[model samples]
Target: MTNREKYNQAFIETLEITADQLGDDLTYQSIEAWDSVGHMQLVSALEDAFDIMMDTDDIIDLSSYPLGIEILKKYDVEFS
Candidate 1:
């Protein structure tokens, strides 16, 4: 899967949401499913999916779906 697909899948699995429900507008606490607990789950899922350990700052800075791409790019994760 491409990086975009992997990113979406991480959110899908971690947030227990459908793919159709995800978007750039999707942010932390934007939905009931993306609460504090869900945020950490997403962090873990993204780490597992991308095979990289994110710094605490990056993890905390990942406040939105679009921001995720930017943050992941710092780890050399390219999106297509």
Candidate 2:
């Protein structure tokens, strides 16, 4: 699968959310399933899916979907 597809799938699986439910507005604290545990799961999932380990700064900055994409891009992950 593509990077976007993998990211979307990881989000869905880790957060137990639907594709339609993912967006900038759907932040970590905004969703029921996006708690601390889910946040770590998402980080792990994204790392595994993209084969890139994230730094603490990136992890802290990944507070939203858009931020996650940006963070992945910093690791040389092409979204398209």
Candidate 3:
């Protein structure tokens, strides 16, 4: 899968959400499934999928779907 596909998959599996549900509005604490536990799950999924570890600051800053894409880009995980 491409980076975009893997990114979507992480959110899908971690949030127990559908691909259609992902968007800029999808954020941490914005939904029942995106609690602290779910956030870590998503982080783990992304790390594993991208083969890169994220810094604590990056993890905390990744508060939204759009922001997550930005954070990953810092690690060279291009979306397109």
Provide the global lDDT of candidate 1 against the true structure: 0.92
User: Which sections of candidate 2 miss by over 4 Å?
Assistant: none
Question: Regarding TM-score, does 2 or 3 come out ahead?
Answer: 3
- Against the true structure, what is each candidate's TM-score? 0.94, 0.95, 0.96
Please give the CA lDDT of all the candidate structures: 0.92, 0.89, 0.93
What are the RMSDs of all candidates, in order? 0.8, 0.8, 0.6
lDDT of 2 by residue, 1-80 (tens): 88899989999998888899978797878887888888999999999998889999888888999889988999999987
Q: Is candidate 1 or candidate 2 better by lDDT?
A: 1
lDDT of 3: 0.93
Task: Compose the digit string of candidate 1's lDDT tens values, residues 1-80.
Answer: 88889999999988988987888779999999899899999999999999999999998999998899999999999997
Q: What is the descending TM-score order?
A: 3, 2, 1
Give the Å error, residue 31, model 2. Answer: 0.6
Clashing pairs in 2: none
Error of 1 at 22 (Å): 1.4
